[model samples]
Target: MKRILRLLYYMRRYWWQALASVFLMAAVGLLDAFRVLLVQPIFDHVLHPGSPSQIISLYKIPGTHYQFTLQQFVPHFIHNVWAVVAFTLVVSTLLKSVCDYAGTYLVNYAGFGMITDLRDDLYEAVLRRSLSFFQKHATGTLLSTLINDIERVQYAMSSVLSEFLQQFFTLIFTIGVVVHFGGKLSWALLIFVPVVIGSIRRIGRDVRQTTRRGQDRLAEIQNILHETITGNRIVKAFNMEFWELLRFRDAAKRLFKANLRSVRAQAISSPLMDSIGAIAIALLLLVGRGQIQRGAMTEGAFFGFIVALFKLYDPVRRFATFYNNFQQALGASSTIFTFMDDQDDLVEKHRAFTLKGFQKSIRIEDVGFAYRDDEGEKNVLHNINLEIRCGEVVALVGPSGAGKSTLVNLIPRFFDVTSGRILIDGHDLRDVSTRSLRDQIGKVTQETILFNDTVRNNIAYGQPDVPIQRVQDAARAALAHDFIMRLPEGYDTLIGEKGFRLSGGERQRLAIARALVKDAPILILDEATSALDTESESLVQAALSNLMAGRTVVVIAHRLSTVRRATRIAVMEQGHITAIGSHEELMQQSPIYQKLYQLQFMDVQELPEPVMMGKSGL
Candidate 1:
């Protein structure tokens, strides 16, 4: 019931349209019942030509002595009984048809408008979630919720809800007719209604459960499809085509079984409701026949009553289908609401300050972190402390899984530290607004990320209004200007997905240009040139030199030679920073740093002295 109310709340913005549709539906229902009322007049007056123009009581106003007649409905000019009946029939039918059309369109307009707002809010909520939320939820599962689940809801809102309202109003008017004619007999005949309603409700519950299960299986199928399509290169290189096909087939079969169960649940309701309706009609016929023979009821009145009963039952049957569809929508809404209700823990404080510039050191004070804060999860970084001064390049050297990347990730508050805090320019990072903190930091990773956009757009991504000349200057600094000009469209060339149109070195250079364009006070490079060939690495390394110039840089690298000339090198192992010093200072004081250098540079030529950097440093 709460979920139902929530759905109605979404429709509140379109209340005027929905209310108009309801009024139209009510008029259609009354006109339909009025058409049934005409049956009595035709039999009593029109069919019997000698019969007098008697007043036919169509309806009695509730709690009043007043009653409506066919005479009141027909035009004053129409004196003949047959003509009056014919005129009323044509007009009532036409009016009912008009109201039905207008009601359907208006209801659908309200429904579509509500869904547009709902989908937009859901999308914005998903984007606002922290990185951990995305890491926990699969991309395909989120897509299924955003697309397939919402589609089911859309159908229910636009189609099922409109039908339900129309039929509901029709049922009310038809019931009034049945009560007026059948009198006390109507109560006895409708005893079977509760049984039919109970059966429908039970079937609807089963359908909802099975529909949820089917949606889950569908999500699994989507997940496999996304993974196989996006990672096609890896799958082909591994020669696992058959394996992927089998995996997809398994998920498809599971979904098929789930859908079958939902079908079974929905199928049971129709026949059960129909059988009960048939029994009630049979009883009404048996009783109605006696009422007519005893002269207690007129033949025409009994016939009109039978017609009204049929109309009532028609809407009842439609209600069963509507309830089933409503259940399916509710199942989908349950998942959507779960995500919408989730609040990200990384929310900024109400009075959080916006950081404008980096004026002092970034102090990491005994920081400890774990990806998951729940018990039984191991810490990725432990008791880690470091200080990086302005305009200094501090390189973090460690083996794989030594928390090098994780520690740098903390500086940007991608995930908050499990314990302790990081301060930038003497203020806690947590006290700063996330957008402002990220705005002042630039990052370039080993795997370049470039969208399927023009090279110019890619370079000036964040600053969309940046002048073309500034973009060219940044590109030149990153060693990317020469190649960009050689393309068919120069800077306007459309780089395909992930910049696949460019070479590894060219892509890396473009990423550096993006960072150069940002010109952030702080820079983070994680294995920036490690993936490239030697020649490519040299070019990227030179570009990196330009990017790191006069910035507070924190670099993560496995190759020891790259950082031998850094302002300071921090050696990390097993989540702990074991040493922090210059190359010569670390060689004498730290054995871990000494052994790492000896093991990595044993087969390569080592620089004899610390190389001095001019304006730019590598």
Candidate 2:
């Protein structure tokens, strides 16, 4: 409830629209009630002037001498009555058209405006969430919230305004008509109201529960759909099309069953209420007949009583329908509110600490961390101590699972370290605003995730407002400028999704170009050139050398050549640095480094001994 209230708070500025909708709905409902009340005037003033046979013609058809019957009376009459009926019909038709148009305009117009804003706000919330937040909720589930959940609440909003306002007004207006017709008979319904309302409340509760289950099922379907689309390659590679289809079918079936149950209950409610209302109508008719027999009220009065009875129940039926909608609305709104109610993962300090310029260095003192899982056990990176001074270049090298990426990730506080403090230029990284801290570093990783945008857009992404000449220079250093110029659209050529259209080398170079453009002081290169072929690697290596000339660079290298260029190589094993020295020093002192060097070093220039007289070194 609080969640929805906050959503409503955003809509406060649109109150004029909501106010107008309510006004239109109330006006329309009362006008409908007035139309129903017109029956009394027709019965008394037009139809029952005297005996039925005493009715006279109001117009003349000279050619055929045709006469309109009672069914087509008033406007069709062959007398003065024709003129009055025609005028009355024209006026009533106009009011009905105007009221219907205004009601439609206000209700739908406002519902769309409110929910569209709601979707944007919901998306904004998602974007503001941390990367870990995305890991916890799949694209499908989040997408379901954006689409299905919001749509469900939209109907709830429309129903709330339309049904609640219209029915309440109609009920009041009908009560007046009923009491005017016959207060005693209308009072009889007072006793019956409690039973009907009690039954409605019971049914409404079940409808809400079922509606919630239906939405949950929809989320599953959404999640499965997202998985299949994104993992379509894997599905095809594994020949699991049938399995994927089955998974989606299962999710769809669950949603179908849930919706069928909910809608069945909702469908039965109205007809059941209508049947009961018919019995009540029959009771009113009988009571009215008795009054007519006793000469207490005339036949016209009895007729009017029944007419008023129908009018009262019309609003009652609508109110019951509104209750059904309210139940489903509550079910949908609960999820939306829950999403809106979440506290942001990163809590910002009330006052941000501002730093003037970079001076000293980055320090990781006795730093340790673990990937915290749901089960509360921390995986270990212990007794870690490392430092990177200004203008220094260090390389981190180890086997596959050595936590090279994770260690660097902590520098930017992408994930806060589990049990250590990282200081940047003498200030704790946490104390510095994440934005300000990140602004001081640049990164280029192996898997270059590029958007489907122009080459200019991708290169200048890190610094969008950078001048064109600077962007061009960075591209030239990346060796991407010549190729980009050769493309059909030059720098404006659109890269396909994830840069799929570009060769592996081209994509890697683009990423380097982006990093170079930012020109941040502290740079982390995570196997940045791993995917490039020998030719591309050679070209990128030159570009990278230029890019790393003066920056405080930390390179996480797997290949031997990349590491040899680092000023200092930190040999990491099991998440801790085992040896820290230049390539020559490490090759002499580090045993692990010697083992790796021996394993890859060129064997004897020409077979050390004479190969068994023949076969040589075949």
Candidate 3:
């Protein structure tokens, strides 16, 4: 009920249009009932062929005050009756047509406005939700809510609101006219109504349930599409395209079945309602004939009663259809409301810390993290501690599953530590504004996530409004300028999907240029050259060395040569930072680091020792 009330409340902003539309519809109903009144006179004068004197009892000339009965004034009698009948029919027809146009225009205006607002509101709600909301919900499920569900709700708005208002008013007005024409016969309608009402409601309930299932199936369809697009390479490599195609087909078939059920429910309401109405009309006719024979009602009155009763049945049939449409909108409303009310994963602190500058060091004090999967088993990172001095290059290296990536991930507060704290300079990471904290660091990952934008835009991505010359200089620093200029459109050339058109080294170089353009005081390189061939790795490494100049750099190292160049190396194992020292020092002290060196560098030129980067005289 609250959901329905909220929907009505929002729709109330367009109430002037809705009210005007309804009033016009009511006028049309009244006019329709008025036409029933004309039937009595039509029967008495024209159908019955009443005496001329009786048909035209009162006649006054336009320019003279002479009046006479139709027995003496037959010409005036015929003219007046024909004129009045034609004029009344024309006026009633015109009023009905005008009323329909007004109602249609106003109702449609409000319906369109309501749906447009809802679409915009839902989109805004999606953007405002935190990362955790995204993690918990599939991207495809959200797409379902945005597209399929929103469209369903909008489709319902037209029939549900307009038909409800118009049909309900028509029903009430038709009832009043039927009672005015013959009261006792009107009461006989009550018997047949309950059965039809109950049956239609049963159908509506089924439709509501099936509509929800249909939306869920649509979500599954969206999920399959999103996954297929994102993991196309994986699908190709594994040769599972056929399996994915079958899965999508199954999801679509389920949706088709669900929608078919909803359609059946919606389709039955009108016919069933109309059949019940027809039975009620038949009952009225049976009782009404006796009243006419006893002279309790005129022939015209009986005819009028049946006419209004049949006309009244249309609105009742329409009301049942409106209920079915309302159910569809109700199903979608739940998803929209859920999106609007979601709790954000990251929130601005009550008293957000003021981030001034990097001073002493970034201290990780006994930081531990665990990412729990669906079954509640956690992948843990345990008791990791490090202090990174400003303007020093620190590298992290160990065997697979060492949690090195996770440790660096915490420093940027991408994921909060499960235990202990990460402090920037001296302020706790949680206390600072996320935007402010992130602004102080630049990250270049192994997967260079370049947008399908031009070279200039990609380089200036961090600072969108940065000058082109500054962007050029950054690209030059990253050694990406030469290749970018060679493209047909030069800096304006579009990078294909995920920088597909560019080489692996070229994409990494572009990413470095983007980071360099930002000129952040701290930089993070997450195995940026790990997947590259030696020539490309050399290029990326050279670019990396230039990038680390005068900045605090954190490297997640896969190569022994890269680890050797770091000022300090941290060895992590089983979620803990087991060792940290210079390459020579770690080789002497850390078995994990020593083993990593032997295994990784054995195929290439061996490294003598780990280097330790320190501040001047620090």
Candidate achieving the largest lDDT: 1
| lDDT tens readout by residue for model 1, 1-618 | 998899889999999999999999999988888788888778877788876556667777889999987778677888778888899999999999999999999999999999888899899999888888998888889999999999999999998888888888888988888888788778876688779779889999998999999999999999999999889999999999999999999999999999999999999877887888888999999988998889878788888888888888898887888999999999999999899889786878888989989988999999999876446677899999999999999999877789998899899988889998999998898899999999989999868999999999999998999999999999999999999999999999999999989998999999999999999999998865346688877788888888988999999865555576489999999999999989889889989887777766343566455578888765
Q: After superposition, how far is residue 415 of candidate 2 from its true place, in Å?
A: 1.7
- What would the per-residue lDDT of candidate 3 be over residues 228-297, giving only the tens digit for each residue? 9989999999999999999999999998998898788788887888778777877778899999999987
RMSD of each: 5.8, 8.0, 7.8
Model 1's alpha-carbon lDDT is 0.88
Which runs in model 2 stand beyond 4 Å of their true positions? 1-4, 51-93, 355-357, 462-465, 528-530, 589-618
User: Candidates' lDDT values, in order?
Assistant: 0.88, 0.76, 0.81
lDDT of 3 at 426: 88
Best prediction by TM-score: 1
Displacement of the residue 416 alpha carbon in candidate 3, Å: 3.1
**Candidate with better lDDT, 1 vs 3:** 1
Q: Which of the predicted structures, 1 or 2, would earn the higher TM-score when compared with the native?
A: 1
Sorted by TM-score, highest first, which candidate order results?
1, 2, 3
Candidate 3 positional error at 235, Å: 2.5
**How big is the RMSD of model 3?**
7.8
lDDT of 3 at 223: 97
